[model samples]
Target chain A: MEKFKKNERVVALIKILSDNPNQVITLNRFSELLNAAKSTISEDISAARKIIECLALGEIETIPGALGGVKYKPILTLEQSLEFLKRLCTELKDPSRIIPGSFIYMSDVLGNADQVATIGRIFASCFKEKNADYIVTIETKGITPAIMTARAMNIPLVIARTGNRVTEGTTISVNYVSGSKKIQTMSVSKRSIKEGSKVILIDDFMKAGSTIKGLKDLMSEFKAEVVGTGVIMSTAEPDHKVIDDYVSLLILNDVDETSKTISIIPGIK
Target chain B: MEKFKKNERVVALIKILSDNPNQVITLNRFSELLNAAKSTISEDISAARKIIECLALGEIETIPGALGGVKYKPILTLEQSLEFLKRLCTELKDPSRIIPGSFIYMSDVLGNADQVATIGRIFASCFKEKNADYIVTIETKGITPAIMTARAMNIPLVIARTGNRVTEGTTISVNYVSGSKKIQTMSVSKRSIKEGSKVILIDDFMKAGSTIKGLKDLMSEFKAEVVGTGVIMSTAEPDHKVIDDYVSLLILNDVDETSKTISIIPGIK
Candidate 1:
């Protein structure tokens, strides 16, 4: 095999590590793939680390010993995350986003791939230390960000449906009252989650946190631990929520249909 | 400004291009970022392209002239895609996957971020040439791969809801008969898709292709053109489908409850 230049080897190394975030890749494997010596691969990783951290791109972690290898951590700094959220707040504050019921229409923002990836990175930064085995969310609105968060963390995602369905095989169902005082049923497959696994719950919006509270109850039935929770938006009013420990990306202060004005800010200072 | 080493520069270039797949980044920008000359950045891009294509990782194409720049295309070769599908088939063939009513429980596979990302890469490779404006799906199961596809293509994602909702603002509703011979209402926010836009429809499963057919009809209402369509799996029983042109990654032949075996294969040879 022809020897690859240092620059070429570094590019390939970064591509693989970034593609599979948080997944370890042993130096022996990289050595075989790049056809380079272990010492040379080590040097490449050192250079990659400097480039990543110096640019504030993220982190490049190297685990030592026989089973250890290199992995990419897409952690964002406080300033970087706040800058992203501030831009999001500006875009979301556009008066045209207000609907008739004084609700802000943010479906487009949530559905955009890169935007959600950034949001997921923020959530991943918050909960990556939890050693979560899965990222959980309900169907419909929450799936996008939850999947992204799961992707960033390199974990499986579990979706809870609003109603029980036969397609999922034997399932466990729980009925809980939503924020509006309406009763709703949520169900998950019996085997979707392993018992005693730690999970991070993610969603797009929260009003009174009733749905999340219900989701927590459902997690309990699975014998899973809710290590952390994150939401994109939460209403400013009703400061006290049904769930006590969860992170919200944005705080939606007001939506005036009549005045066509919206007041929103990043959830974290 | 301080200058960086060649290896460090290539690493940064590869990271940004891979992070935003198919999004163009000009040499001038790279030159500015790395504090290097345009010609130096050009050489770096050439080396990166050779390394990427040499390893069969993907493609790094550089467009010439004033407005042209470099972009990463995560296209999978025939051998690469088939190998991935074959591995998936092995995992999915486990007899334990069969639930009652002869349905295979695949939520775990669908929600696995890395798995879906590969599927999306295949779809993106198939449809990236169509100049699609958005990737569309009808909520729930399809959202994961669809969002991933959209991510790979660097486009927006438009999700059609099951019903008209006030939260999305003024909405457009369409009634379409699904694969199960059930009349279903699917709606998209009027502003979700612009008039005369081009889109690609993606879904998790297609039995009779009724849902996809319905989705195509909904696109007609917006005067949008569906440039392409893709599904992760399609039933082999229905040799004839409502939609004629679509790509399926896997063809689900049968789920024999009595035999405790599943007949499945890669969608394409």
Candidate 2:
């Protein structure tokens, strides 16, 4: 703790931001961290923000809320993030990667750069609003964005692991049916979250609501609140909760595997 | 394209690095970029390195090679990275995450902040070698590390998708078993990468060789070479590959579903 003086203020600010979870903070709140006057804290913050911004790190936004303050956009610019995703897509786009159904496989995209960067930035940005204390994602696809967002917000990222990891802690498993006409069970740990914390649910693709519902069932044990839900991409297939209020990077309306025709639509930027 | 100065020397230097992944770079090769006097280029490099180091962003390591040039440790310090990983694990270790047989799932650790920061530092360190052309990862779990790693390396991050999307020009899919015992297919598109790219692969977990093998197959199609492979965690499963060189944060030995005992081990620093 003693060695933290030089970086204390920044560290303190980071902790405050983390504790707020999906909420934005104004200059006034940051000023209260120290005995220094609001102006002095503001000056320090401006200098700190410059360093972070120049690095293409996080962002700072001013919200006109009733208790308006400068909110940190834990997310980065879309341009900055797209480059990372483009790279991943590029590699996966290789002719060698061609498969039978004309379906472009993307296990790597779920785990690669641009997709990861965009996921991180978006999650961070979404949580910049208050009331989001934790990030939740269905096993497999949803974990990527959930991780990125949780980390940016400096909060814990909880995963509803697809099934059971026999060697870990306690688990909460829920069974659900997929559109593919298969029933599956997803599980999560009982120790990875806090009671009453607001949770944001995320998924990679939402063809149905079963998986999201499974996550909701799991959260029930913790008595947590579902603050928001998001998806990276979505299809036109209906029958899901429609995600109370959601954000998506792209929308794939139709995929004709035979014609090799695919439609890609950018989400609300 | 016109914006990049045609520094044949710098280009050549980078190429040399790409060919030799994870190796240190000396000043002599840097001088070769400009065909300038060794002493002159040395000074320029020193200035350049100063700017880089001053940013507290990337590492510009200096090693005294046999040829008496500098060898940079482009990777992050083990201590810094370990600390961050521990913090992530601790946070992910929330008590509210307890599920019966499930664990505090960490599929998303790939893109979370502490992990991303640590991963960024680590990959940035690798880029200091000046050879990594691209960062690679299989879909889903690999995206987070690949994104942070690519960001740190300031290179493009490539992902292997699972299915083909029409938006992608051309794609190749390979069938392989993911860690979960599911024989799933992975995909990548054509024209995403050129031949002979030096790539660093990062993944969230490595329980089986299938996904990596699928990625390797995809890479082979593009004539791209795998320079390094990284993971956040690896399980000591009999089915796991032992010969492949990888960097991981933690190692899981056995997950006893009945006893609720999970044996954990730390990876090499």
Candidate 3:
């Protein structure tokens, strides 16, 4: 095996930990992989942690038990989170984003991979302690951020289908009222989630929280617990939603189709 | 700005470059961000690249000239790709995954974030040279891998809806035959993809190639060229498909419903 210097070990450590966020990596494995000593690996981790903290590049946690070693937590600082949301608000406030039906043309924002991953990291930071077993979202627009959140949190992403598809095999479904007041059905594979598992419900946008409520109802069928709920954006109207106690990154306060202007602000202060 | 040691600098460089894959980061930007001299940052990058190559993490390319800079490409070497695929095949071979309709229950596999990211990295390695402007896929299953692939390539992900949703503004719809011989409609927002841009179509499964064909048709309406098509898995019985040029990670050779057995092998030699 080839010997690695401290710089090389640090690089390898950061890459491996970043790739598998929130998952523990034993020191012995790193020692074997890098052909380094445990003490050297420990020192390397301290150096990596310092740079990560100094640069605000998430958190590197060390678990001190026999089963513990090190793990990367995608926790963004409060300042970083606010800065990102503020920037997102500006991008979303562009006049040209307004469509005929007062809808914001956000396909470009939601479709950008790097941007979505950043949003995912923010969410992961927000609900890091919920200890979620899975991140759940309905199909279509929500999958992008939900999958990213799952990736950041190092968890499985369970996407409920708009309707039960044959490919999913034995799904439990629930009907929910959509933003347009139309009744819609969503379903999840029966085996996708386990009973009594803790889950986080993540959505791209929330209007009345009906979709979140419906997802909650579906989770009940599987006997799973909804530990956290997060939405990238939520409408400000209707003051009271069907379900409260959810974190939203941005608030869509108003949209003027005639003036071609949109008023969006950061949510949750 | 706090000065960083060589080990710390390597850690920060790996974190930043790993976070933004396939995207260029100039030495000046690194110098400003890390509070290091340009020449020092260059050496740090060299150290990072050496360890990355040593561990088969990916490639770090240094582009030359005025617009040149360092970029991280998520290209898994041949050995790594085969190892991942073979392990996936072994996992998929478990008889418990067989559904009543002979459909394999792949929700768990598709929903795994870290594993899916690995698959995305493999796809990125497969299509890295295509220089696609965007990664495109149809709704639901394909979105996970597609978004991950887009993240790996540092590009945008464009998803075509199964049906025209009111949320998406002015979509272009196309009707095509599904694998089960049902005519289905898929649509993409008119402004979602740029006209005359190059795109890569990604799908989770290809059966009879109708879904992939439909997505290609939808891409054509926008005057976008389909530079490459990739599927995680493709069935072998058809022996013929609407499209001939594509890459598949795995081949589903057979599924015996009675025996609850599935035979899947790595595709593309």
List TM-score per model, in order. Answer: 0.98, 0.59, 0.98
The digit string of per-residue lDDT tens for model 3 on B197-253 reads 999999999988989999888888999999999999999979989998999999999
lDDT of each: 0.92, 0.59, 0.90
lDDT against true structure, model 3: 0.90
lDDT of 1 by residue, A1-269 (tens): 98999989999999999999989999999999999999999999998999999999999988988899999998888899999999999999999998887889999998899999999999999987899998999988899999999999999999999898767999998999976698999999999999999989999999999999999999999899999999999999889898888899999999888888999999976
List candidate 2 stretches off by more than 4 Å.
Answer: A1-42, A47-71, A75-112, A236-244, A253-269, B1-56, B59-112, B123-130, B133-143, B154-196, B203-223, B232-241, B244-269
Give the TM-score (vs. native) of candidate 2. Answer: 0.59
Error of 2 at A134 (Å): 1.9
| lDDT for model 1 | 0.92
Q: What DockQ does each prediction reach against the true complex?
A: 0.90, 0.16, 0.84
List ranges where model 1 is wrong by over 4 Å: none
Q: After superposition, how far is residue A258 of candidate 3 from its true place, in Å?
A: 1.2
Cα displacement (Å) at residue B15, model 2: 28
Q: What DockQ does candidate 3 score?
A: 0.84
lDDT of 3 by residue, A145-255 (tens): 999999899899999988778888888989989888889999999889989999999999998899999999999999999999999999999789999889999999999
Query: For candidate 2, lDDT tens digit of each residue in B58-104?
Result: 34445665666643333556565666666665655554433454443
lDDT of 1 by residue, B1-269 (tens): 78898889999999999998989999889999999999999898988899999999899987889998999999999899999999999999999999988788899998999999999999998886899999999978899999999999999999999988777888888898976587989999999999999999999999889899989999999999999999999999779898898999999999999999999999977
